[model samples]
Target chain A: MTVPSRILVVDDDADIRTLLGEYLRRHGFQAEGACDGASMRERLHRAEFDLVVLDLTLPLEDGLDVCRDLRTRSDVPVIMLTARGAPIDRSVGLEIGADDYVAKPFEPRELLARIRAVLRRTTGKASAVRPEATRHIRFAAWTFDPTARHIVNAAGVIVALSGSEFRLLRAFLEHPRQVLSRDRLLALTSGSDVDAFDRSIDLQVSRLRQKLRDDAKAPLLIKTIRSEGYMLACHVTEPA
Target chain B: MTVRVFVILVLGILFAIAGTLHATAIFHGPPFRPTLQLSVLGICTLSLAFITARMVTRPLRGLAGAATRLGRDIDAAPLPVTGPTEVKDASMAFNAMQRRIRANVSERTGMLAAITHDLQTPVTRLRLRVEKVEDDDLRARLIGDLASMSDMIRDGLEWARSIDVAEPFGRLDLDALLDSVCSDAQDAGHDVVLREESAAIVLGSVSALRRCFTNVIDNAVAYGGRADVSCVVDGARAIVRVRDSGPGLSDHQLGSVFDPFYRVEASRSRATGGTGLGLTITRNIVVRHGGTVSLRNRAEGGLEVTLDLPLAGAE
Candidate 1:
């Protein structure tokens, strides 16, 4: 008899708020809607919410402002819904203690996956609060800008990673020198929503190894453990 | 004003010639040493003509340089109105024209940004609402249509952004960039191959150049089924050829392919899913980097897009 997670959807458009509310509810969450920041604050005051899906473009007081204010008072997870191609807003949202972001015009399934991933990460207490400051993750001659979602090599060349590749790399960077099982890797990278298999994880790992220029037969950076899983054999550092 | 300057220049030269002749007649004896006098007159006329020509052309040269600067940067400073009356008038007119063009460009960009920004909310709403459709087939088709619509909207915004030259230029490895783009395309299951690459370093806006190549490759993949890309540095220019295996375009279509909204196969574009602005944006980015992009039907049966970019420190 476990209670479902409570979610709050904050958007100016009534139709959007209602639709997202219904969608979240149908996905087994107790969802509530707020038309703007003022009502969002009132909802928070009245009830407890595990997550807040805040839209960046809201009337009068915007989502960023609301999220910033909420961060000062509470540690509740905030997921920003930003416009596509608004990279600045996305980075700023993440910098302001928001947990994750889903670009607008996104697939509903994608949003659901993001919501689930954020909830899982938060509840698991893997580094309780997301680092408030934006930092670049450096590992073995590669620099990863989590905000920009790209990797730069020692030669100062930027390499763009596909979404899954980025998530996989981030997971490895976050936990270096530890063998990550296929199931754990899949959960971290694709969330639980995707019907991915162990082979897909292997394929993704091989592709990533190719990008890193690591030989598959005798890999140097990412080593495959016998009967265990993959482990990043390099030291990872987060440089400001 | 120019005519007046010309008249004065002519009069000054005539006076100098007459003075030189008078001096030669008075100073020299009977025959006047015609050879020396003629040489002296020729030297005087030549010196006067050279000085007058320089004086007149200096103002024109300044105006020409300013015009060239304006062509490269719309926000270039106005020409200094400190020359002869005609030159001043011409510069003033040029400055006014520059101002008008800047205003118009900003206005159009602002409007496009506003429209794109406003469209996102409703599109998102529609996407969410459409998910509730009971019929699975109808829902999938509706989602497909919405996805394409969103793609067009996103492309429109990108096209508008391509006009902005605010991106910082950096030295980029052409081979590495091509490798990444091709690899990414391959990862996406697009039939793209980087057949050849050279260690070519180019000075360009990294994102803009990336977008340019991506659009070209995407276009090739969408229409041509596959893209065979090759890059080589020839002397001072890095030449990249993206060859596609699609049916080659007609001569008329080739001429208009880069034109905005001009799709070679209009009906095919709907199926392939592009706003027909890919090549247009590609050209915009290439030209901004002082590069030239051209498309031609391959002799063997396909279309080849050639991009010639100046290597870093070469130009």
Candidate 2:
């Protein structure tokens, strides 16, 4: 038997609270609702939740304050709902420890995906998969650091990787020397973007190879196993 | 300013005539030497008057140029309050009015934010409720229609907030930014290629520029079958051209493409979830960065959108 995840939906709108609760329940999760920060605190006292869907604007107490309080008190995953596509609100939401953000008029499916991703991130040690805490991954005389969002080459020059490149490289390091299929790489690296197996992975790999100084004509590091998938043809280790 | 130029020219002519008469009378009727000296004096005075008039018109031209520059980017450095007191006062007043205009626009954006903020809750509620529609096709259609409506309203809010750029300017690598955007578009299954990379440095709002390029590139991929993006450092401007191999816009329809909510056809973008606000927001952000964006139908086949953004030292 498997235990269903408990989700708390916090919004001033009663209709949203009810709809989210019903929707999550229909999807085989234990769901509950709270109108504002006070009722949310009461619910927290009575039970534990696996995640929180928090709205940024609220009555009496703002959602940021509630999130701050939740961060100090517990480790519940928080997904912020922002009003517009304002970059500032997204930054502030992340800076204040919200795990992820979704803009208004969002597809429920999108939010559901974010919730699952956040849950996977938070439910450590309980699952078979490992967490992404490794700071520096070394491979083929190069230092790939996820925290710094850069990679250091053999000549000790730091090269910045784009967001997608960093995610794709990290996916490679997680399973080195294994011929991972395009589908697997897409699943591992997919976020809001790159939701499918596309030529983007091939292009990203080529660009990453160029940065790593891997020979594109006869690649030594990331090799393409034709008719199969791609493999990081190198020994990867964590550098202290 | 033209009126001032006309007044200065009239004054210069009057001064020239008056000086000629004065020189003639001062020398009286001396035959050779006096006449030669008076001619020299008269010519010198007229030239002096003409040069002074030119000097007066110079700052006026500066003011006009400053106005045009300020129109493009509100954050551009204000007109230096030099020159005559009247000019100084005008420059100072213009700067103050620019600040007021900026504040007023931002205030309007703030209000739009408030109203849109209230709207999201209901929209979210309605979307969630639509999941219980029972009929598979009905549920999907309701969800899709609701999602489009939400996107449209969100675009409305984003359109209002477009003028409000709260991001700070930073030293951005142009090549890297373009590469990232094209890569993202390519990842989303678009045929986007970064053909050329001419790296340049620019002081601009990173987020705003990113959104600007993404919007343009997205339009290319959506409308054009494929997108070929390139960057070049042409003097002080970083020129970015995004060309797509799709059916280009007709000449008559091109002028209205950037208008808010203006769609070439009702069904074209609606199916793709485009709110028709992408170009509007892109234009607002590019103009905020002292850039000009233009679109033209390429004779070879598709649409080509070019953006020329001023570099840090260009202006």
Candidate 3:
């Protein structure tokens, strides 16, 4: 029998910590709660946790400080929860080595999905730390800033992206020159629990293509494979 | 300023009286020439008084103009303190008052933002706790209520933040912004279409402008069923129009639609789900960018929202 993954949730709010702990436990994970940074440290010293869900607004020491300190000491995945959904805060969170970020007032299911995704990405690796922080990714005369979650064209025009389109594009940029099937694309962008409607992937791809200004009839950027899936027909370079 | 004007008026009246007395005494010796000399002296004194009065009231008129400008924009430049002593002192006081008002407004906005931000924690906690309810329908209803509460809190924060002018202005492609906004709305399954595009560029705060456009489009989709948006550059102004196909609003309703918390009772029911501050925030953002937004009922049974923004190089 497989042992459930252990998770530690750090939040100042007692009710939230307790409720989230219970929810995670109900979903078949060993969950623990910490009131603040000191307790969180003590818990980490006492037991091994697969992931840490850290709240950005703590009593004294914030989640950013805690995550930075944790990064120096350990490679466990940390997902930041912030009440402020500002773009600057998100970029700063990711820059400080957070695995993912979830704004407050988020759905519990969404949080669960994020936690699972982060765990899967970490456990699949030999060393649990994320490969260096994502920087500006360049592909096909376009500059994509993963931290800002937007793209700038060769003419310096910023093209705003929808959530699904961003995720799909990021997925493609991460693995270029490979045929990513519709099911894989769906699972990568919208979690595995979503109902796999094949047409949604095609529609999302077409929309992303339109945003990229890639000709749909004879697409030069993203190519469709017959009886398989789609592939990014371009080289992606990441600059620090 | 008032004291200086009063003194000028008194001095002018005294001079006019002295002139009259001197003219009467000198002309008393003559017969026909006496009447002519008296009348000329009277006209010259009247003209001199008129010139002095205008000079004295010029500072007062300037103060009034400055006050009117301050009323329209809280961050207007301070009144230039170049006048008589009393006028200078009055302008100094007016500038101080303007500073105090600006501080008070910023403080109020900060307080509202802090309060609204703090509400997120409890709302998130409540939402998570709601998940524990075993009954599906009860849990769903509870979640819905929580969602609307959070929505109101979010809107409240947005309204408070709409007055902020901290964002730096930059050249933005209007065509690209509208295209992205419309595409985003369409992606979310809303009935939004970008019928026309303009290559005009405007200097604006990017995120704030995006929010402004998004609020208008969202309102149209909510009340008017679908939004057909277009943009055109006419001379130095870029005009954007968003039209919808639903039943048009009444004349009275159209007038009050942009007012904060004003809703059309017949069509904009609670089920439509808005705090009614969408248009108010939009108008605030538009006015901040030196633009105007207006709503009018279309002849073909719909509502059209027009936004006019000055082109980047026009000013």
User: Going through the candidates in order, what is the number of backbone clashes in each?
Assistant: 0, 0, 0
- Write out the backbone clash pairs for model 2: none
| Candidate 3 residue pairs that clash | none
Residue A100 deviation, candidate 3, in Å? 3.5
lDDT at position B109, candidate 1: 74
Model 2, C-alpha of A54: deviation from truth (Å): 2.0
Q: lDDT tens digits, residues A1-240, model 1? A: 078999999988899999988998888999999988889899999999898999988879878899999888777788899887665787788877787888877778888888888786566554444532246778899987777546778987666565567678877876689999988887777653344333388988997897787899999999999889999999887775
The two-chain DockQ for each candidate, comma-separated, is: 0.39, 0.35, 0.32
How much does candidate 2 score in TM-score?
A: 0.77
What are the per-residue Cα lDDT tens digits for candidate 1 across B36-91?
A: 66676676678777766776678889889988877767777888787768878988
Note the residue pairs that clash in candidate 1.
none
Best by DockQ: 1
Q: In candidate 2, which residue ranges exceed 4 Å CA deviation?
A: A125-163, A169-188, A192-195, A198-240, B1-32, B36-40, B47-51, B75-114, B266-269, B311-315
Q: Where does candidate 3 chain A have its weakest 10-residue lDDT segment?
A: A190-199
lDDT of 3 by residue, A90-149 (tens): 777887788788888777887888888777655756553343245577999998876654
- Please give the ranking of all candidate structures by DockQ, highest first, separated by commas: 1, 2, 3
Comparing to the true complex, what docking class would candidate 1 get?
acceptable
What value does DockQ give for candidate 1? Answer: 0.39
